[model samples]
Target: MQVIPLKYGTIFKRAFGQPDVFCQFTKDILGIEINIDKVHTEYEYPEPIGFVRSKYDLFAEDTEKRIIVEIQQVKEDDFFDRFLYYHLISMVEQVGGYQAYGFDRTVYTIVVLTSTPRDGSINFSCAVSDMNPIDEYGRTFVVYPHRLVFLCPRQVNDKTPPLVKKWLNFIEDSLDGEMDEVDYPDTFWKKIMAAIQKQTINPALLSEIKDDAAWEEAKIRFVAEGVEKGLGKGREEGRAMLLKQQRETVLQAREMGLDEMAIAKLTGLTAQELKKITK
Candidate 1:
């Protein structure tokens, strides 16, 4: 059946928004059993705590822990830093009133990268990060419950876990073209796939997919033109032209409702640089 790629923001949100699919996914990927009634998409902190805010792709919480799942189709230079901030912010938000700064619930962040990661050490299909402290005497402290997991579908191999591999394979296959129903025989997989079937997608989502495609094409064209213009000009001129293009792209992305952090990721601009450009 023709399946819409889950790499797209709208499609990803739609499929995983269902509680069962989300629970099944987290169970397989994180090996955690969680029962959740609602999944929040594009979730933001109700009150902005500081200058920066976080908007998560998928967020769910039970009594003991909060789960965040982010799907990043575009590779960001500060991918690790960005997600770390998101993880911490979720923990920090728990503190209220004059109470002690004790965290009531642990936070778990799962980042799924559809593209190959730029970091060499992240060659494996799955990597986990946590706050397990170790002493010089080979002693370990397992105090912190918070954890971060990175999943790169493109890096799947023989060593990858079978269930995790199947999930990743589904994501990778959908991006390529039509996905055979026979390949996803599991009831859970079939349910997830049905959520993103081409026939079920409404006209509004179809338009969004088209707009995303156009934006990607425009970025490619812009980069190509910038490179050609740079080759035809002096070093200083080329730098100036590139900077101009970057500023224009930032403004366009903002108009399209992309956050500053997202724009920085796509343009390789720093927060300060983005502020200056937008100002």
Candidate 2:
């Protein structure tokens, strides 16, 4: 059976929207117990200009902290910068409408990358203290502890914990060909698989998935074609520039009262080649 694309926004919402699933996901990423007060999907941050800004994949907050969960299938060069920007925006939105001395709650940004990064690390994390100096006890002035957690599905292996590995497998594996080969753990894997199966049956959801897939496919194709065209154009321009420089050199040599033979020796052009330019 074809599995739902977890990286897709609609499918991600359908598969993990359940409070139970989202809570489990939170714990798996944070490696700590969390009581989620509410879960919002495709949540729009408060745009001060009211122009409708970017929407997060998942936004959940509790009394102590707010979590932003995102699934990125394609890797970009400025991925870290983008996530940092998103993290800052999330923090800003907390106090957007209300006045406060500082953010009362911490912000956590969790990103699941379906693609492998250059370093091939399965997991990467960053915190404020890593970039700044702090004492052994840690800095007391830090109120909002913003963190970034990245999980690369391709790099998950036996060394990973059972539950974490299972969750990664569920998100990445299609479970189509080798059905009986791998035995997934009972709870989270089963819940996600069952939810995907159930959600796939909804005709509207299925249609939406198909449409989104088509749109994404078209986008990839367009980008690939654009890059190819750009490269071709660049090569053409490069050749033209080289030819112009060669011609300019020949003209410059002639201006200096040098014969065709001297120009040929200086520019590494044959006598015939020099004649072709002078002709």
Candidate 3:
């Protein structure tokens, strides 16, 4: 479509994880009046592999608490690993210079994730939510009084919940050069279009971007030369060497009474090919 979401958040994070994207969200998205007193990226806590060290997409400070925004594309089962790490990082402010090593400070972690669960089928494939949250003031809610929420696709409709309504639309759908009618702020829309235009409007960037999109498209082309190259590269010599090795393995497996499906899975050879070998 016309515009893509301002992701490359990972890319942007790589460039400016300390203060740019991290601070933008708190000030812009949350409409919070907080001055960024300090900011750090790749925060490390001296401990083991899973201990207080994490490279955040963006991490920063405000007047009251530390705001950590993690930009992720794919969702994994152990996603809470992100929250757990951020929880640890929040301890940094209180334990200034490691003196107060175990003090509890507030942290706001918002994970921007992939598409949402459509039709409210409870798609928790890549999400962890408090099966319950306390209403702060009807405008805000917190899960376990620590984290906020994950923004995904299905949360973008006119009637969807407010937390992700802006974010979901920015990523899934494109803007029609008209931002007023939409839900997200105009400045946020500008950031979105800036990301998309970087990948589309320029001649060279367009070639690269469209090539990325087109490569995913499947098309068939018959070519004798490709087949010839496949066959002619050490044709008989390599073939004899590997064929014997492969055939011997297949034969041994067959002798063990394994079925055709099992042999196919092991060798990546077609059932028909395995049958020919056996015969």
Candidate 4:
């Protein structure tokens, strides 16, 4: 009984897209609590004409702030650029008129990446900081509410917070189908496990997941085969080039009036081999 990867396409969306689960997850990652009623999952919004469609993993709006959660399985070069765009769009959608200036709400962006970032940090956070010349004077500076949090599961370690560490362990091993020894707070774990199990039991969904896994495996094998063939061809070409150089050396020695035995000795070729080349 193979378990579907929790980070893959639809399984990821279905597993964490539940209202209760996502809200709790938001709390765990950001250390902020929000009303469950405000959380919306798989929410779609209109994009510019002639552009691709847009959908969000989760959207939560409260009296003072709006939160957007994104789960990324694969890394992208323009990930931050796109995330800023989404943050801006979410802010734009909230205010319709110029008079709504002071009525703007704070926006928080959360991204969970299964792949580690290039800097090798386990967790990354960005915020609107107020720069000060020196902190020794105990001067306080105001910070903006626009913030971003990145969670990288690969880098989680003992230094991580207890709850978050346990949760990350659960997510990393979710595909193993062996949760009996998990030591997390049981209620939260059970809630999330139930959501995962619900989708895992669907026959059509399971088939699609299996097919995608097979395709990925086949693609990897195809790439490996191509690399192997390329190396073999390169080796053959190198051997052929060496042989051509050796033949040229033999001819050059013969042109210098060297005798058959002398040429054979100088070129390290047997008399019979030298005769074939000369003929």
Candidate 5:
């Protein structure tokens, strides 16, 4: 399949707005079906108390299976902690906190992460409660909505389970433009293309992405963030200059018999600033 990866914004729109894509993705990855019939973020989950809002790439669900999936793009540090927070909120919201029943209705928490690729670390790693920690067994802690499946594209391989393979391939191929057509679901190709076309549109952002035909121009755009940061520093210096001028003016006034309170009120200067003016 000729899979095309989505840009930052398009990810949210396509996943939530396109139910076919959303529903199939959930089923293929997490082995569950959602009522994609009516999927909306603010409409469904309705961010609750203490939930950190706007910290995720996608807050998704397969309502049929009562499943909620959050996609987090990991940058560094064990920021998975935030993903964990969102996941817990999702679970809490689903089961109505401490009041609701059936804490384990096969809830699946999935994370799709893109990072600077690590070799040797499997491209896909899945974690399930080690079923036998006591006798080499562990528990799933059925006290809340059931399972969590995280698909870090930086971690998968052919050895990955079938479902995860489809997802990992989706992410990998979409990124590199060399999609493994045979391995993915039939509809995967079309869904991805539509999302990408949507991204290539909006000529303004498109121009921003593709600007810099000259390598110098490209380099400047890439490091444009540093330029933006320097503007902050520049503003600090400008403010200092103005402050220095104000201090000098206040000092001149004081030497010429201006009252300290009068100088303070005129310059809107703090007592500390006024002291500097005098000194």
Candidate 6:
């Protein structure tokens, strides 16, 4: 049986939007236990306090922490910077008065990337940003509790923790429409699997999936035609034209949220070549 992938924003929000599921996910991924009163999806602050307003995919709060979870399907050039801004916003919003210099709640920003990340150092399924103050002798002090965590399901390996790996594997399998409850024996996974079953998805969500598929197909055809046209030119001119086309396609695909591996296959470009083009 086919299951709707949680990588999609709509499906992701629907599945993890539940308070219990969100809490379980947080505990599994970050090793933090939070009893959130509610899970807010596509959450926006009531008033714009900064020069630019930020909308979060998932936002929740307990007494001592503010949680921001963002699901990113596309690999953008400024992916890191964008999330950093969101993380800061969550922290800054706590400022109420001039005398209140201390933040009451610690902010935790967790980013889940469905596609391969642009940073090569993030070669694992999960990683956390280090904000501890370190001395010359390597002694560290935890003055700051705010944290940033990144989860890349596409990068799972045997080294990955079993609890985290199961969730990452579930995400990978869902993308291929092959999610199985047997593989995810946890009760939490059972609930998530039932939540995103293809047959149970609403009509509107199914329509969105159909539209997205059509758009992806169109992008592939566009790349193919560009390659064909470039090959019809003079030998030397054709090579240059083809290179230009591939670069343009790479940029377009990145903006459309297409993963790097798929873009390389479609453009007939190697990983090194794609990196150069993107750079």
lDDT of 1: 0.86
Report the Cα RMSD per candidate: 15.9, 4.2, 11.1, 6.2, 11.8, 14.1
TM-score of 2: 0.76
| Candidate 4 structure, TM-score to reference | 0.64
Choose the strongest candidate by TM-score. Answer: 1
Full-model lDDT, candidate 6: 0.83
Model 2 bad stretches (over 4 Å): 45-52, 75-78, 96-100, 116-144, 157-164, 175-182, 252-279
Question: Please, what is the whole-model Cα lDDT of each candidate in the order they appear?
Answer: 0.86, 0.70, 0.54, 0.66, 0.56, 0.83
Q: Which wins on TM-score, candidate 1 or candidate 4?
A: 1
Model 6: how far residue 208 lies from native, Å: 3.5
Query: Which candidate would rank higher by lDDT, 4 or 5?
Result: 4
Off by over 4 Å in 1: 117-122, 227-279
Clashes of each: 0, 0, 1, 0, 16, 0
* 1-279 per-residue lDDT for model 2 (tens digits): 446757677777776777788888878767656687567988885555233366788888888888888878654667767777777776766664555547667788887776655565434322222123467787655433577777666667667666576667766674231222246557666666666663345898888878977987897789789989999999999988987888889999899999888888899989877767655
TM of each candidate vs. truth: 0.78, 0.76, 0.48, 0.64, 0.55, 0.75
Q: lDDT value for candidate 5?
A: 0.56
In model 4, which regions exceed 4 Å deviation?
1-3, 47-53, 100-103, 117-140, 181-185, 198-200, 207-279
Give the CA lDDT, 0 to 100, for residue 174 in model 1. Answer: 86
For candidate 1, report its TM-score.
0.78
Clashes of 6: 0
Tens digits of per-residue lDDT, candidate 6, 1-279, equal: 578776777788888888998898888887889987899988998878589989999999999988888988653568788988898888788886898678799999999988874557557788888578999999989888899988889999988899888778877888887665777788878888888899998898889877766775676589678878777756778778887888888999989999989998888888999998767
